[model samples]
Target: MTEPADAKAVRAAETAVAAEAPDGAGASIRAEHLVQRFGSGRGAVLAVDDVSFELDREPARIVSLVGQSGSGKSTIARQVLGLQRPTSGAVTYGGKDVLRLNRKQRSEFRRNVQPVFQDPYAIFNPFYRVDRVFWTAVRKLTDLPNKRAADEAIRDSLRAVKLQPESVLGRYPHQLSGGQRQRIMLARIHLLRPQFVIADEPTSMLDAQTRRGFLDILQDFRVRYGITTLFITHDLSSVHYLGGDIMVINKGRIVEQGAVAEVMAAPSHDYTRLLLASVPAPDPDQRWTERIDIGQIR
Candidate 1:
């Protein structure tokens, strides 16, 4: 497939930025001893417990944080995106603390590190046309000279995600299908061409086929645009499909970490094993025989 016009523009912009930046400028997002606590005294809940990981910028790849719901996976993402400050520890981007970045640095960080959140419906305004999202992004994040340039960029971005511009541009959030709305978010990412993507359960709301397509696009971004992703999810099937490094968190702790294939083949932690076993088998002839005690893992 031919690269989209907007993609070409992003490539040119990236090249320009690379030329001006100094050597060893490919910095990573690092979380050191991260801890997030909510409430107080005996009721205080430790959402994240000493979670430490590094998302490197070189050789772009997907690193999945897998766990059950309320397992601190999303909390870690919030910290990484500077949406919420950790109670203890730090989230640093390019060797500087994310919370402490200056205006310029913060702007650059926001541009370079973007998010694809879980709920597509919640991302847009029902009161306005869906095009507003793209227009707002163009106005704030891009230096497109005029309305014509912005329009072209938006059209090309929609095309890049396999959405026809005419069908999607003027519709409200309620007018589009779930998959189309999610792909619109992906198109936004394609337009921005961010170095890192914080995809928090981006495919959970899509159908099986749509979910696969979404994962394929993420892989393509890594291959074509070098957009590394921190894929946060509870689905072991999705984790196995998007094969990369895997970190298994259970009860606010990283119980196991390794390559997806390796960990899937021989999971060291019981929680990891439970997650893998939970994945439904494709063949009806294969019966699930393992009995799990929920209390034991906890």
Candidate 2:
């Protein structure tokens, strides 16, 4: 992490900053001057360039990060998850610089923020029981009493994602529908009860019906656990449906960011207008499987 900042020095800076902007329990996550680059200082590819955002209050509020491929949304999400250290800035969870955290602190923060990756089909193993995924998560994150207590926690967690726990038990990932498997991923995080979820294109791989259902299920989780979400997608219509606030990114930069209504109704940035122009219109003649991809936008 010293490739970006010295950890001891960062702790001191965090201490000073926390004294100034004491967000208390309201601040779930925050990123300041977040930059992710690959290569050297003078010449490098900028994956995420000085991007800064925060989620304070609005416990279950949903925010969507919309951008083309390589626009840095995923990179920023990784930074928020503490997977990648920032090249320059800082990412903080509850007043501390999380990138500087030790193993114990890192594990604790992980329970607060978990990722729900796209492509649910690839999210699991054919070898291990699907329940094993959840069980392993529980083992790593918590120390419950016994198998019964762990099983109870698993059941409650699956129920949170609208899954029938009994139906999914002892099943392999390949046996479940794409939706069910994705729900299992959500269920795993719910078991941990993370305060925020960074969902990277959670619905991209599903069919239209399943995609809509995915949205409903996630919204249900929000209602159940009061989980704030940084929902990442390239779909404008999906954003219209689920986003409380919208941030449009282009080539590793934020073009516009604000409430969904204001941003979409009157998109000031050209890139955002491009996104608006690019929403698929319903055509009865077209195949229902018509998909939205990065290439479709002009």
Alpha carbon deviation, residue 141, candidate 2 (Å): 1.6
- Residues 127-159, model 2: lDDT tens digits: 888987777666666567688999999998888
RMSD to the native, candidate 1? Answer: 7.2
TM-scores of all models? 0.86, 0.84
User: How high is the lDDT of residue 63 in model 1?
Assistant: 97
| Per-residue alpha-carbon lDDT of candidate 1 for residues 107-196, written as tens digits (9 for 90 to 100) | 677777877777777767689898987876776677777999889989988988889999999999899999999999899898777789
Clashing pairs in 1: none
Models, CA RMSD each: 7.2, 7.0
User: Candidate 2 clashing pairs?
Assistant: none
lDDT of 1 at 81: 83
**Superposed Cα deviation of residue 106, candidate 2 (Å):** 2.2
